[model samples]
Target chain A: MATVAGHPETPLIEPVDRGEGLGHSIVRALSHAPLTILLAFIGVMWLVPTLGLFFTSLLPASVISSEGWWTIFSTPSNATLENYRNIFSDEAITSALLTTVWISIGSTILPIIVAALAAYAFAWMDFPGRDWLFIGVIAMIVVPIQMALIPIFSLYDRVHLFDTLAGLILFHTAFGLPLAIFLLRNFFVGIPGELLEAARIDGASEIRIFTRLILPLSWPAIASLAIFQFLWTWNDLIVALSLARSTQPITVAIFTQLRQFGANIEIIAPAAFLSLTIPLVVFFAFQRYFVQGLLAGSVK
Target chain B: MTDSSITAEPPNQGAPPTADEAGADPGRRRRFLVALGFLAPALVFLGVWIVYPTVYTVVRSFYDRSGDAFVGLDNYGTLFTTDILLTAIRNNAIWVLVVPAVVTAIGLVFGVLTERIRWSVAFKTAVFMPMAISMFAAGVIWHIMYTQDPSQGTINAAVRVVSDAVNPPGVLSGAAPSGDDLRGSAAQGYRLQGELKAGEVAHLGLTRIPASEVKDGVQAVVPATVEGGITGVVWRDFKPGGGGTAGEVEDGEVGIPGVTLRLTDASGAEVATATSGADGVFTFPDVGDASYRLGIASETFRESYGGVSWLGPRLITPAIIIAYIWVWAGFAMVVIAAGLAAIPRDVLEAARTDGATEWQVFRRVTAPLLAPVLSVVFITMIINVLKVFDIVLSVAPPSVQDDANVIALAMWRTSFGGVNDFGLGSAIAVFLFLLVIPVLLLNVRRFRREA
Candidate 1:
């Protein structure tokens, strides 16, 4: 009945009849026909636009200009892979795709590592002003990235990190930390204290306990954080738009093409489709953690 | 360590701690240092990227454009006064008022509806697919859909088809009457100046007919007089290269087909109507023997309906908002769906068993239960909307970019899009920060309570 995987104790809707005959089941199904139709209608409305764009991307540019995308159904032979081929072959597009990959990886991994360590300290270790420090970091979550842009722009310019991939990655990692730490620390605090105490009695150092015990135990939280951070960096445009001039990501690349070419669908459609495909693949692959992370981050 | 402490000191004598006690202080200090070490990297990042920049921006907002001179509150004053910036603020207000509410409502409906359907998984996946894509890609998709050309734009094509079926457009929309015989405006029907009897013939000529609009097999022919009614010919009077006499049907000139002629008496009441034939010859055979004025129907000369200008200045902000909703509604749905799944089923079953109608259950029980999730969606959307940049940049045409600007886009433009006014840009940025603070506080408070 489409229950949340994380909350298996509660189903969205209880089934009215579990052991009913076929006729009774049929009647129950018939009663929900209106709702089924409404949901189907909404589903179609959501799918058609993306489907139209996908079909448009497949068709030859000449056909796209002369006929509506819906016409692809009647004449499916007109579709081609030339647009995708062209974009893949283009140097700018390939470079941008590479940039996006490396940036996402760097941004995702750097923040996870840093935040995991900080989260471990906040959760287990006793330090002076630890609670206050954690709260201070959490409060920084509200600072809009706009609040950082001008100064960082100047900072990057002075440090020669302005248009570099590293600069973008660093910016993403820094911004990604607050929520990452919050999520991971919350998860870390749930672990039993005896596990760490036993390891400490066996003479495990703080670093060893962190690397061996805490990191291994908190995989679920870390996985979700990883996926969340990866998607954030992957889909980001504004930060890349502002800071990275030469080392542009796919989002920035597509945006620039849209502005410069002005609805040059052949270049834009395939490139944009490719840009979104990676995240969709990742999202579906790790769909469980994605949802878990979403709920953990927000519905607390 | 406890045994050493117990054995080294007598319980009755309140003496100073033994050597082991003194050693424990350094151990505690070492643990503190170790914790600091673990936190050091993140602390550096937070301080450098977020903390330092936030302070710098607030301070920079008070300085002049060059940053050398201190100009207190001047940039903030200019932000309120400037037309472009004000438009940005207005658009942002519109966005905040519209996007979060609409998106959340759609999300709520989808979330609830999917629960009743068997193929709920497929429905959710379809709706939630857009969330995986970047806003730039979504913007491009909608931008293509909103193109001005009907053949290219899916939306305009659909609109044109529906509108055309409901009220067919005029064929000779831009055609104008030639000579002094027609004596009325384009909005009102053009009427022949002279009165005509049943047997009389009238020749109406039109100019400015586009060559592309003239249909094939339309030939200019002189109307044959019928027995009881007047006859007329409406044709393209001016031939190519301008050789034809005005108000006359010349050879090689095409007929203005589909022109509806209204026959009105001296009292201005319509008597009969006739549409011109393919050859531009129209005859009203049933008109009585009376003086009448032959007028072309105004509907015949009205402009054909093109689809709406979706990216025009008037609709650009709304158009962009629609795209924003398309990209974000899925997120709201997924979050709310999670919230829905977390709701206990027995409460709903109990409410249903008590004879509560579905609407009542939804309005009274379900909605209140989903309030926290809904607010989560709403506030998240508000924060996202305030920072909206990519969709606006991609979807809005350059000519109307200013018309669709929000504060985030305005800030980017002021600082980086060749303006280089960092001081003013910082002020806008800080102003955005100020606007976000209350929402931020609410979120933090919620997080704290939950923790």
Candidate 2:
């Protein structure tokens, strides 16, 4: 009988001729040893710093410097919420946080909606220069932000968009549309055309067909795109820094603290940890859809 | 869930052949509307931010600072000839060369290796954490790590601690105390150079001088004539204040008007002094194996004695590559892992039963089967890398970034980094638009082939 170690049903559990095959098993074990060590080393090197950041974020500032963050298990009483409290206490920080939230939400929703609609057009709707137009949109992806900054800034300034939040959101949405459209269009195309045709036969218009049929079936993709767009916007510092010239985002606000804080690991450790929380939350909520969204165009 | 009925006959009969054909006309109208709707906001935004300013920058680059007069490539000519501009270009080139290759190689190797682990998710998340942090934040973090002092820096402290335990004189702090003769007969002369310093640590010939005595120290070093072979105390001295045997030089060796030179030997012994001529030439005797220090007094750039410029929080291409690899490798791994899972066990069993080697079977069968996955990964990476901006902007040199920068960083710099030069910025953006089109076309063609 075969009995897999993890999955009991799959492993071969034959005990026949154990002594005869002993040398082969040992050799096999030796060969696999290197792989095991490599994996462990890679995992530890990658995870420790992040884990340290996470642990340090939870502890008091004084504890972060004097002791390793791993020592939190020994002194549970050293933990404090002061860093986060300070983060929110500042008007600038809180406003920046609010600005970030708004920007992330707006940028994510707007781009996804626009991209999905455009994706639908490119995917299913037959039009003249359909391929060419999409190619144009996709081409926009390579228009590096550097080439556009001064022009964008001056344009924004001319139109009085210097430091406004609305300006930043618009700028992000413009740049974000190309990639979002590319991703969602591929996913929308993967959906069986019969599903949309089936809906249309029952007297639903193209818009209705999209709203009820394509949108629901493409929820997984939409979720994934939402995550990507949201995170991209949330983690964005340059575009926000440039376009949001007046209003600061979390990235900028955190940066100002760094200049003043110097080696105050208490503030920086916690702040660094706190800064990532939103993205992590977004990831946890949308990760299930990531696989589905990713597989949409690849499988069929 | 929809109220749509299952039809015995398909809806394609009365329509324009099939769905692909049915919407040929209506689809065109719909697409026109949709593209118009989609492009409207983007064009408006891009027009203002990308198109307008970029075009403006090209125009501005040709103009003076006030931008009132036409100067016909004078600005670009100036940029080439100016010493500062030359240095800036060199630094930028170094950044371009070092950053991308290192970052990409590390990323690709790690991405492949980490995929085999059971706990790959955790491993990837950790590495990708830097991606989530803004470039500015990453810059700050790296700055702290690269900090000169060990007490305040994690990297330096670790180096010092390891070196101290092993070699004794501390690796990072100062000379490893090779116990070699530094102050013997070999140390007959020294130079009076200064830089950003930490606590007391013995280096080759560097010395700490009090801030109050700098003026007098310069005076004591100057000699009557800075003749060649002017050996130790072989040269007489004078001060500019007393107007002694020292010549009434117009300016110091560095050529700056107010700045004076105080040359010292390799052992911190003051040797001679000279000021710049009217043409801004300050001459001093050449010394062997001696380090020279420069002090600047300029109107454009302001600093006390020594301060580094362009230490802004920005990633060059290499850092971007490293950061991007961290961010996207997880994505690539997960996709590849899923594709691997999808391969049926019977295929492997069939290969094993046929006496085929595992490597051969995997290569011929698994790799070929993973073609779709490979295409997807390649396309995504290409797209992602094309749009990368934050990493570069957050780590690039601060003072001299211009249109000659990367496409994305230039876009941001021109718009908001003051002096908003849009026309030229837009022209470059148009070029960027040209560059990305082929990649996007390739993606569309790949999907079209699949379809």
Model 2 C-alpha lDDT per residue in residues B213-254, reported as the tens digit of each score? 223222222224333422111111222334433323222211
Mind sharing the TM-score for model 2?
A: 0.63
Identify the runs in model 1 with alpha carbons over 4 angstroms from their true place.
A1-34, A59-68, A71-78, A261-265, B1-23, B176-257, B276-285
lDDT of 1 by residue, B25-89 (tens): 77988877998999999999999999999999999999998899999999999999999999999
lDDT of 2 at A177: 78
User: What residue runs in model 2 are displaced by over 4 Å at the alpha carbon?
Assistant: A1-31, A54-79, A259-268, A291-300, B1-121, B124-136, B169-332, B335-389, B392-415, B418-441, B444-451
Question: Relative to the unseen true structure, what is the Cα RMSD of model 1?
Answer: 8.4
Among these predictions, the greatest TM-score belongs to: 1
Chain A TM-score (model 1): 0.89
